[model samples]
Structure formats: structure tokens, C-alpha cells
Target chain A: MSDVSAHPSLSGYEVPIDSWTQPFWDATATRKLVLPRCADCDRFRWPPGPFCPGCHSQRVEWVPAGDGQIYSFTIITKGDGDQHQVFVPALIEFPEAGGLRLVAAIVETPLAAVRIGARVELSWSHAANATVPVFKIVTL
Target chain B: MKHESAIAGVGATPYYFRGQSAPQTLYEMICKAILAAVEDAGLTIRDVDGLAFYSMGFDSGLIAESLGIPELTFASTVSGTGGGSAGVLDLAAMAVETGRAKTVICVGACQQLQIRYGTAFSHMPVTPEKAWERAAGLTGPGQVFALIARRHMHTYGTRREAFAEVVISSRLYAATRESAIRRRPLSIDEYMAAPMLADPLCRLDFTLETDGAVAFVVTSGERARDLKRRPVYIAASAHGGTCEWGRAFHWLNMPDPIFTTAGSEPIAARLYAAAGIGPKEIDVALIYDHFSPLVIMQLEDYGFCHRGEGGAFVESGAIRINGSIPVNPHGGHLSEAYIIGMTHIREAVEQLRGEAVNQIEGAQFALVTGGPAPIPMSGAILRN
Candidate 1:
């Protein structure tokens, strides 16, 4: 994983943390990325669901999330009329997690530095009520 | 699902820019559209027995009471956003085919006075799913789809000009219609000059935020024959997508091919099978154009051309008003008004009935698609 310096403070915003996703949010406080893994099927679920789509099992555990590859991305030159702020949101795919991908911001990276196949490791962005898992570019 | 169900009439209130239709409430627009559709079908409002709607359908009981629809028998709504626009027709058709109702009204309405669609997602009360997206500063459909557009360019070496062609083609078609909000065609240079909302998607690429209502009258083929005008036969109608495309742009978990594509290939296949026709048989295509790149992607998904060849196909002027496929000849959501995917259906009905402004000579078949959304993205085929 990249250093915290590469992760920007996104503290002003608040992300709704529900019981189903509370564990994921709790793990993020320590800058640790955890995803729900089906205890029976051993498949990881993104967005932390109640049951497995494949095995339809309710038994699950939160395991440390692995690094991902940037599947695709976009740079927002402007958002909400905030002309000065630029956002780089990318779809990061975790191959080990049953190929489940998550939408995260590519923080502290120059717009020119992001590429489709770049490898990315988990990072943290602090929201008002929870710590959100973001990502930073890393060497393959 | 077959020629048993047909669209007897189509109608819409004037398309107005966001907030321009304020004096008229959403329900009022719905009433206007329903009444207009009833009259267009040469049937009195009393003849309508059922009401069908999609995308946050308003209360049917209220509408039935207000419009004084006599003896409402069937009232239902298809789920999902604009993705269910065309799917709602399936509900109406099913009701008519099953003899549950002789006449059904399929409607969609929007009034952007308070809630604007352009920045729609930003105002959403964050749920667990939205929490992940909102935290990443990903708001609005354009921002999310931009990632897919970027992947498409990366995967197929698609150029921005193809998207430009999509927009210009719609504008060219809209130029001939006084109903279109954007009638002036744009040059490639002008499109390139437009401000970027999201990288790879300029202002011109997104659909216009309009306030209006569009409605259609559907009935059994036997009854349609006795109506005022020619009936646009519902040869086929389909909704739903592959499991991989679940949640679509919002989740972005779909694998390669499915990720970059429009995610409509499966729906298109089912539609073709149900219609007993192929892509070549389609004379006009009213594809949903919420974003320009999706239009290109859908062209490929619908088999207008081979996969990954949509950019080139569109660039060759094959989607123009006089082109082989003649896509969006009534100006799609891009140049026409974006009443969700309702306008596209209206265009399909008009084209098939030989009443479209940019009419394709002897057009026999028309294809209309709902917006490229999550599971339940839909499409339909109509024949004259």
C-alpha cells in the first residue's frame, strides 16, 4: 500500500454507514481495507452484501482487501461548480475478490499519471462520519 | 410480445427546458399527454381502461380519478429509471394481450422545476451503495459513465469524433423539426469547443434536461385496426440484462467486453428473437442517447455493425438521416427533448406510422431502446 501522504483528506463529506457495511467502515479507520468474504464459498462481495450471489450463503467474514488494477477511470475537470477542485474516479478491479471491482478515487495522483492498467493499492480518505477506502498508484 | 399488441397512438406536451414548465405540475403534464394520446387514437378518455407507467410512476389511482377514466381494471408500473421506459410498453401490451384491459395508457412524465436531472445524483440522500460513490466525488450519471467511455476509447482506440458524429446526426435530424429544442446542427469544431463536463464527455454529449410528459395508447391488434390512424405493431418488447451488467455504471464490476460495451447485447438478442427479425431488417433506430458514446456502443450492441466497430460506423455517416440505419431521425434525446426515453418511443411510433418529420420512405420496422442502465435496460421493435 502507498503512504498516507498520497491520500488526501476527504473529511468534509459524510458517507452513510449501515449495519451491513459497518465493518468495512470500521476497518478503514486504521487505513485497512476489508471486504466481506463468504465463509462457505470463500468469495468476496463488493458493497458488502448480506448473502453470496453464487452460494447464497449468509455466513461471511471481513478479510483484508488486496490490491487492484485500474480497469477504467475519468478525470472531472469540474464538479458541483467547484472549478478549482478536480476529481479522478476510477474503477479498480480486485482479481482475487472474484473479479469484483469498486469505484474509488485515485488520490494524490496527477491526472497525466493515471492509466487503465496501472496497479493500485488501498488508501484511506476520511469522511465526516467514516473512513472511505480510496486508492493510490503503485508499481506492478 | 408479438403482433397481438400495438401502439395505437403517441402524444407529448411541448418540450420545455428545465423549470420552464413550472406552472404545470407533473400530474398536469401527465393528464395533458394522456388526453392527447386518447384523442390521437381517435378514442375518448372513457375508452381507456388501464394505466401503465415506468420510472417512479405516479399514483395510478389519482390519475384515474383525475382523468375520470371509467372503470380502471389494470394499473401497474415497471421498475428502474429511464431503463424501464420501453419496458413499460410491455406491461401495457401484456394487459391488452391478456384481455385484462382493452386499452392501456403507457406514460412517462418529468418536471425539473425543483429536482434537476443533470446534477441529480449529487442531491441524493446517500445510502450504503451511494455512500461509496458519493465519497469518491462521483455524482451525476455523466461522471460515472465517463469512466466507461474512457475504457471504450482505450479498448478500441475510438476517437472523440465518433461521439461528435452521433450528436451532429441528431441535430441534423432535429433541424427539420420545429419540436426539437436543439435544431441547429453543430460542426465538429463547435462540438470540440464545448466545455467538458467529464473528460471524454463534453456538454454537447449529454442529453438535455427538459420538463414534459409523453404518453402512448396501446391496445389489442384487433382493436387498433379500428382506431383513427395506422397502428404501430409491437413486434417485440424486452427488458432485463445479463447478471454481469448488474448495477451497471454505478458498480463498474462487469468484466471486459461487457464493461466497455453498452451492456445491451443480451437485451438486443432477446428482442431480435422475439421479433423474428435481425438488425438488417430494422429501417430506423431510435436509440437512447443520454450520452453520445452510449449511442455508438448501442449501435454495436444492437448489431448495426460488428462489436467495437460502432465508432467507425458512426464516423462514416452511416447513422445520418439518410444513412443505412437512419438512427434517431426524430432527433433522439440528444437533439430532441429528453423526457427520459419516452421521446424515443414516440419517434418509433411516428416513424413506423409514416408520420415522422424525417420519415424514412416505406419504413417497415423501427427499433427503440431505453437508456443504457443497470439490469432491466430495455428495448422494443415496432412495425408498420
Candidate 2:
């Protein structure tokens, strides 16, 4: 992976970190993609919301998602090279985590083989004091 | 719902870069379009009581203040579908049916061309999940839609030639449209040779970003009867979303995820049912073409063709200006400019009014749609 400082410039403004998403970043540092799974509904949620989208349950807990399947992905061939270095992004759905779908990059597969539904395992890269959780193909 | 509203007026700022001579503020664009639309309707700004705009547009209070409208009655902002233009129909329906407000103005504007350029994912709210997605460099619309294009090719026997057909047809329509940013006609060979943005998706397959604003003023059919222009009635409007966001253990499990059944099966059914017309009755269409493949996908979803036959149907010259169904007569986002599909709606209204730069003769009905992915799909049917 390229250096964080070497990344391409972003548009508009960059948001500062808050407490709700802090744990998510901490888990990413360990290469684990964690989501707030509503203990009541047993479903992983997004936007780090206080309540679940399914049942609007307030009781939510951080859950570990070790593996997932590639729900959808795109291999960007154009753009800043450092930013598009064989970049393969996918929506990984974690069934164990109550079907929480998280967007991440698949680092281990060739671009051509990265199709919809490819099984991927969690991986991590440290960046700017944060561990960014990525995914890699689950090799047989 | 009384089911009686008409788009009385429409307006826009000539497309240009955000900071290029024209005003850069969304408020300025909204005012320009709204004033023009109101004037076109032979009405004054005072006639507008309610307002609906894209969530990404300028603030409602700011716009109302700028327009100097006192005691505004209704206001709303909607987003997520990228089809922010469809808000015109929704707001119009509210104004006419529920009597929320008599005259409603709907506006969509983006200064993206003036703003720093970045991937679509960059615009996603900066949460840990988004940050993780961005850190891995999976941050753009091109990449997301490319996956869809590839999948369509794999599952439906779609070919690059079929994809090229869309580019060629859109360009053909755009060539006659002076407002189109790309006036040059594109051939199949040229489209095929265009540089790839992603595997199977070429540069020509993507829409261009141009700075501009489009607006519409909608009111009750009774009010429209007194307007300057022939009022285009809103026959039907619908939006849908689906959450495969986390569903199955496999990637294909999320295949064909649709957010709005209105833009999908239900919307198509209801639109035809409400309009008392079918896809065959559509004289002109302004399907969003953020990506070429999506145009085909929406064509199928809207019942222009059967499942998995959109590619083949488009290849048959049926989407040409003089063909069975004229689509994107204003060049669409592919050739004209990408204003988050707002311009497509404007083009639909213009075609229905026989005022399009590339006007389709006697076009009575037009169908316009929003984006395909990331959920929240919306659509509208306009008739003169």
C-alpha cells in the first residue's frame, strides 16, 4: 500500500473523528471490521447508529466480522495512480453479524476474478493512527 | 390524493464551470431557474408557496430569503437516489393533491465542477466504514457501476458492441442538441476504442460533469390552465429502495438489488396504470445515463423491454431519435452534462412541449428516472 501522506488530494472538507466511530477505527487497526450489531435483533448496522434499522432496537453491541462475501465491487482503472493502484472495492455482507454489509477493498484477488459474491476474509492496513479494515479473497 | 397537478414552468442557467463567469452559489442558480420558470408560467414569485429541492441543493431558508418570499408554506429536501430532479413531481403532487401549497418550485444544483474533484465515495459521510472503504481506494462511482456493467455482460450475454450502441445513439441525439457539451457524433468503432475507465466500461460509457442548475414550477391543473405555457401534467411518480446491504453469505446474493420498486416493477406498473399508457406510448424518454449500462438496466426495469433483453433491445436501434423509442433527446448525461439527472427531466418537459433543441415531433409523454445504485430510486411521467 502507498503511504498515507502520498495519497491523492480529497474534495471538500475532511471530517474529524467522534466517539461513536472511534471504536470502529480501533477495530480496524487490528484488521477487524466491526459493526454495531443490535443485540436485540442480532443484526449488524451501519452509520454507527444508536438504533437498528430493522427493529429500531436501542441495545446494540460491537461484533466482530472475520469473513464475508463480496456483494458488489468495482475496479477503478482511471484516477490518481496512488489512489487507484489496482484498487478493488467491494460491499462485503457479513451473515454472522446479522447480515451487516460493509464497504471495503479486496486486496488479495486479481481484478478480473473479483466478481459479485466472492468470499473474502478480513485484512488490515495501518494509516494515520487508524487501522483500516480491508478484505482479501479466501484462498482454498 | 386528488391526482391533478401540472408543471407550469421550467428554467435553467446555461451550463458552465462553477466559478466560470456565472454565479457559483446554488441559491443563485435556484433563483435564476425559479424566476424563469415562474415567468414562463406567466406568474410571479409570489405565486410560489411550497418548495422542494435536492438534499444536496442550497438551504431552503437561504433560498427563500434570497427569493424574498414571505411566509413560505411547505419545504422539503430529498437525496440518496442521485435523481434529485424527480422531486419536482413529488412536490407538485403534494401541492396539487394535498393542497399543501399551490405553486411549488423544485430545484437541483451542484457546484461539483467548481469543487475539488474526487471519487463518489469521497462524498460519502465520513464514518469508520466509509473511511475504511476510502483508505483502500475504493472511492468512486465509476468503479461501482463498472462492476454492474461487467456483471450484466457476464449474465445476459451483453457485449461491448451493445454497450457501444448506447453511446452511439446518445451521441447521435446529442449532435442535434447544441446544448450538449459533446456535439461530435460517435461511431461504434470510436466508442469501442475509447479508453477504459474500468474493465468492460469505457470512458464514453460514463457521464460528464458540467456545472449547471435546472428548475421546475409545478401547480394545480386549474392554475396551469391560466399559465403562459401548455402545462405538462404529472401522471405518476414513484421511488423505491432495497437493502441487500447485508443479506447473504455470497456476493451474487445481492444481485439485482433495487431500492425503489417505483423505479422498478411497481413504479412501472403504477405509472402505466395511472397514465393509462404503456412503454409503447412514450414519445420521448430521458432515462438517467450516469453510466451507459444503467440506461439499459432502467429500460428493462421500466418495462421497455423484458428481463435481460435491454442490451439486445438497445442494440436494435430502438432507442434512436426516430426509432421506436427516442431516448435522451438532449444527449442525456452521457453527452449533455451531468447535473445529477436534473437536466434529463428538463429535457423531458421540453420535448413534451416541442421546445427541445433536438425536439422529437409531437412528443406527448416522457419518462425520466433517477440513479440506479446506492438505493433510493425515483421516477416521473410527464405529459403535455
Candidate 3:
């Protein structure tokens, strides 16, 4: 486990929090990241869907997400220039969660230190009207 | 071993940057392109009895009403975002194959500057691309593909030079095409100097947004043979995604994912199988190069080479003129106008007709593909 960081420098974009996505976003407010798992298949789902994409079962449960690794990443250099934002966004994959990947902002990791398969843990930061999940490198 | 229908003629508005001197509105662009293809085929606009487009909201009835098309026996709009460019060709061919229509126009149009897809795409609300993803900084498709590129590099030791080769080859090809958007020769130094838009993807890695429309006329092979221009045979067409392979919609995340599919592999197999020819026969390729790395992936997925050999395969200069297969001789979307990948189809038709600006000697077959991933993609084979 690692300590959560503050909202990123350009992290104040208002995200549309709807009924379908409310549960996932709400978890971030408490500095937690929850993954919606197919209640029937036990497979973790992403982006919030009503049914299990695997079995088409109309059942899901948002459980506290498990640890994941840095599957891959990229440092987006071209921001619209308004956000004062330059950072590395990473795709974190859960080996336990059937290879499901969650895209999260990697904080406190230097660009040179970002490894393709490094372990990571979830952290959250409050940004305009929403709390978004960020990830911290799990250093031994 | 053949397509039941053939592309008799192809036409397009000149490629231009999205907002730079777009001479016509979207409707005007479509009408102009339709008329061009119609005239090229030695037929009147009135001859078109069916229409298909890759998801622009076109009122076929209104466009036809103006063109004096009495009735359209078939009109369809294929979906899949940018991946539908070649899919619409399949739909038009199907319409002509059936008794639904004798002549059909498959059109792809985009006014991205006026209708900034590059901007709106960052805010996409599709399934698995919810607000959380955007809020989490997974906004642009480049970033999504960037993740894929990184994984690919780690998986295969792919180098940035492989990407530069695709861009340079396409740009050099575009330099000869009068309508190509980015005619300026892109050098290795310039490509490397270009700022990274997304990590692993430089600004050049992304496709140019252009305001343009491309249209092609398709009809039965027997009818095509009678047309003025040499009919480019539609040897095969296929479209689908990797959902069955555990890929979530609009997201690259998948179980045991290779990140090489926008449903390209299976579709490529189906294409070669249906056409009764293997990859070696393809003389040129107008692969969808919305981003450069995917072009490498497409090469491999299409069985142009074995899995993981895309990096080296392209490095062999095989994708250049007279090498193995000239790719995007009119520059791809990267250098050419990104008319939503229709230019790729237009280029294929021109090549098969032996009219390509950088025509391959005795070229017979051409391959055209769509966006690399995140949805059901489309592709087709054309033969002279």
C-alpha cells in the first residue's frame, strides 16, 4: 500500500457522473478505487456496463479493486495548453482480475523510471467535481 | 475467388487540411464526389440506384433528389467510427450483388475541422470509454494506442525507426500524389524532432485531419466491364472487432491481448480465404495509418509476415515503391488527407487502374484497411 497524492496540477476537469458510473466515481471520493465485477462470472468489468460482457448476465458488483501492474504507458506532451498539464498516463493491468486494464494517471514516478511491467497500487485525488484514481509505483 | 461486384470508378474532393480552404460544405463535397465518380464511370448521377457511406449523416434521399436518382433500392450507413471506411464498400458491393441496385456509391466524408473529431474524440462517451476514463487522462486515441505501442515494444523490441519508416515511406509516396495533403518530404531527423503528442507517438504518428470526401461507384462485374475505366475488381471485403477474443468495446483492454487487432486478423484471414489468394500476391497496400504503429500491426495481422515480425518486415523496405509492396503510395492518412480512410480506398482503385501517381509496375492487387483497434475494423482487396 502507498500514500495517495494531491490532485494533479491539471486535474480539475468536471467529469460527468451519471447513475451508471456513479458507483465507480463515488469510490474515488473516499480515496479508493473500486472495480465493477460481473456478479455472475466474477470477472471485473470496466467503463461501467449493465451486464457481464463475458456471459451477458445482468448482474455486477463494484468491489474494492485489487493491485495491478503497469502494463504500458505514455507521457502525453500535447495538452490543449490550458491545463498546464504534462504527465504520464499508464495502463494498469490486474493479473488477478482476468487481465482487465484500468487507465490511470501515474503520479510521483519519473519518466525514466516508468517501467512497462512494474507493480502499482491505486490512489485517488479530488479534482473539479470528481475524484479520479491515480496510481503510485509499488517500490520494494 | 472473386468479388461478385466491382468498383467501376472512384472520385474525391482534393485533400486539404481540415479548415484550410474547404471549398464546399459537407453536402456539396458529397455531391461533388458522387458526380465525379458518376462521370468517371461514364454514367449520369441518375444511374446510381444505391448508396452507402461510412457513418456521416447523409440523407441519401435528398442527395438523390437533387441528382435525379429516381429511387435508391438500397441505402445504408455502416458504423464503427473510422473503421467503417472500407466496410461501406462491402455494403455497396453487397447491394450491387443482390438485385437491390445495379449501380451503388460508397462514400466516406469528413469535415473534421468544422466537425473536429480530434477534439470530440477526446470526449467520447461510448461504452467502456465512460467519463471516468477521460477524467483519468485516457482522453485521446493516441494515448490508447500509445499504451499498445509500449506493450508492443516490450513484447517485440520494436524500435521507433520502424514507425519512422512507415511515416517516411507514406510521405514520400504522398509527395508524388497531386492531392496528397502533406506533400512536404518528411525526413528521419524531422520525424525524430517532432514533439511527442502522446508518449511513444509523435505528432507525425497521428493522421492529418482534413475536410474532404471520397466516393466510388460499384456495380456487377458484368456491368463494370462495360464501364469506361478499367474496373478495379473488389476481390474481397471483411469487417469485425475482437470482442469474441475478449476485447471490450472501444477499449484495447483484453484478456491475453496482443494489441494488434481492430479485428484485423480474423478479417484478414477471411479476406485472403474468400479471395483465394495469399498475402504474397498483394502488390500494394493502402493500410489505415491513422497512427503509424498500427500500420506495422496490420501488416503482421494480414499475414504479410509472421506474428511479431511486423517491425522487421517493414524495415526491409518492402513497403516502399518496387520493394515488396508499396504502402500508401499517395501517402496514407498520416501524410494524405484523413478523409476518414476513404482516400485509402480511392488510392487502391487508382493503383489497380495503373493510374497511381507512384504506380507500381504491373500492379494487380491492393490491400486497404481501417483503424487499428478499439472497434470492429474493415478491409478489402482490389484487383485490376
Kindly list the per-residue Cα lDDT of model 3 for residues A1-140, writing each as its tens digit: 12222234445566776666788777778787777888888877766776777798868788866879888878765445554456677778877766777877888765556788888877675667777778878876
Error of 1 at B87 (Å): 0.7
The digit string of per-residue lDDT tens for model 1 on B80-167 reads 7888888988889889888899999999989888777988887878788767788777779998999999999998989999999999
For candidate 2, the per-residue lDDT at B38 reads 83
lDDT of 3 at B113: 48
Q: Which ten residues in a row have the lowest lDDT in candidate 1 chain B?
A: B1-10
Q: Kindly report the TM-score of the first chain in candidate 1.
A: 0.83
Clashes of 2: 8
Q: Is candidate 2 or candidate 3 better by lDDT?
A: 3
All candidates: DockQ: 0.63, 0.30, 0.51
- lDDT-based ranking: 1, 3, 2
Model 1, chain B only, scores a TM-score of 0.98
* Location of the lowest summed lDDT over 10 successive residues in candidate 2 chain B: B245-254
Per-residue lDDT of B153 in model 3: 81
Point to the candidate with the largest TM-score.
Answer: 1
